[model samples]
Target: MARSLDLACRCAQLADELKAKDIIVLDLTRVTPEFDYFIIATGNSRRQLHAIAEEADTLMEKSGSARIGIEGYDSNAWILQDYGDVVLHAFDPASREMYDLERLWADATRVDWQAYLAEHA
Candidate 1:
């Protein structure tokens, strides 16, 4: 389940474009067989949450990636977008606090977004 560098770079770009706070890309290849990476980020409000999710979708689409599904946007508390190799979770602070993916997927290795983006440059 090793993810390609291109996938990681795309994920980071999406996170950056959305102005996601404390963005972290998690490598789930070794732990979860379902997806390769988890792009998790936080938004301050419902508006921000929706914006971030939509921007990610747009980026994925432009990159020739088909979205499999989307959820939790009704409340804007959390939004999940399935993009085959990558799964994006954009959430409001409260929802993010409630369903902390970092803590939930503790087994998955944490990726330093800054370092990752720098290396890719």
Candidate 2:
């Protein structure tokens, strides 16, 4: 659980570095068995989304986190990167509002991403 949380927070920090908006880390361990956490962020454009997704994949892989699957990168509406325990969602503003993942996972606890980053820094 701690490892997954650390990975999720790392993903969130990466998103922040790329200037992704409204970055969030949702703890899904207690709420769901499919994944340990969800790292969600909003990108302003398809180019930005692709860059964010690519960088995230590279960073995770460098950290020994193998990406299990990736989807929607070509479309760029919403890119999903599956890193086993940590799934990342990079969405365009319109798609983010339409899908509303936060609302869907409202039961999950939101990790204090900034605080986590600060503590680790």
Candidate 3:
């Protein structure tokens, strides 16, 4: 599989496996010069947020993708895992509402879940 597709699949799988709510995939390749995609999701609580982050890390590692860094795991209000091409953001509802990364990056293309999966699959 293509690297980008594989990354997207892995991300979708992680989100589903962890029961991430309101999962959104942002195509940041054009919007941001840094990463290709941003996988953003909300967790019910801090514990779930931490679990999502850790699971994403494990999935990335198993897929042979190196984790660049992780931030905000201690509080779990927002946990960020950098995986070079893709960045995973796991947030509790409060933090999600507070930060509103989705609205912040609204100008970027919001990925169509079906299209994304089909293209990546």
Candidate 4:
């Protein structure tokens, strides 16, 4: 559990490093059985979104998390990288607002990922 949380928070940090905005880390432990955490971020453009996704893929790999799959890369609106326990959603600003994942997954716990990084790092 701690390992997964660390991976999730590190992925969120990756998005932040790439200048992704409105980054969120949602703990889905009790909310869903499908995954453990959802790391979502809003990118201003397609390039930025791709950068976040790409970096996340690399980070997850180094964390010993094999990516299960990916989606919406060509769409240039949202890119999803699914690890078994952690999933990342990199979205364009408009796409993020349209999806409103925060509201959609309101039941999940919103993790203060930045604080986690500061304290843990």
Q: Rank the candidates by TM-score, best first.
A: 4, 2, 1, 3
Residue-pair clashes per candidate = 0, 0, 0, 0
For model 4, the stretches where C-alpha displacement exceeds 4 angstroms are: none
lDDT tens string, model 4, 14-106?
888898988999999999999999999999888898889888888888878989999998987999889988999998888898999999999
Worst 10 residues of 4 by lDDT: 57-66
lDDT tens digits by residue: candidate 1, 14-107: 7677677878888888897788888888888888788877877787787777789989989858899898888888888888889988999999
TM-score computed on alpha carbons, candidate 4: 0.96
| Overall lDDT per candidate, in order of appearance | 0.79, 0.92, 0.80, 0.91
**Model 2 compared with the native: what TM-score?**
0.96
Residue-by-residue lDDT tens digits, candidate 2, 31-97: 9899999999999989889888889888888889989999998885899999999999999999999
Ranking by lDDT: 2, 4, 3, 1
Worst 10 residues of 2 by lDDT: 1-10
lDDT of 4: 0.91
Q: Using Cα atoms with residue i matched to residue i, what is each candidate's TM-score against the true structure?
A: 0.87, 0.96, 0.87, 0.96
RMSD of each: 1.9, 0.9, 2.1, 0.8
Off by over 4 Å in 2: none
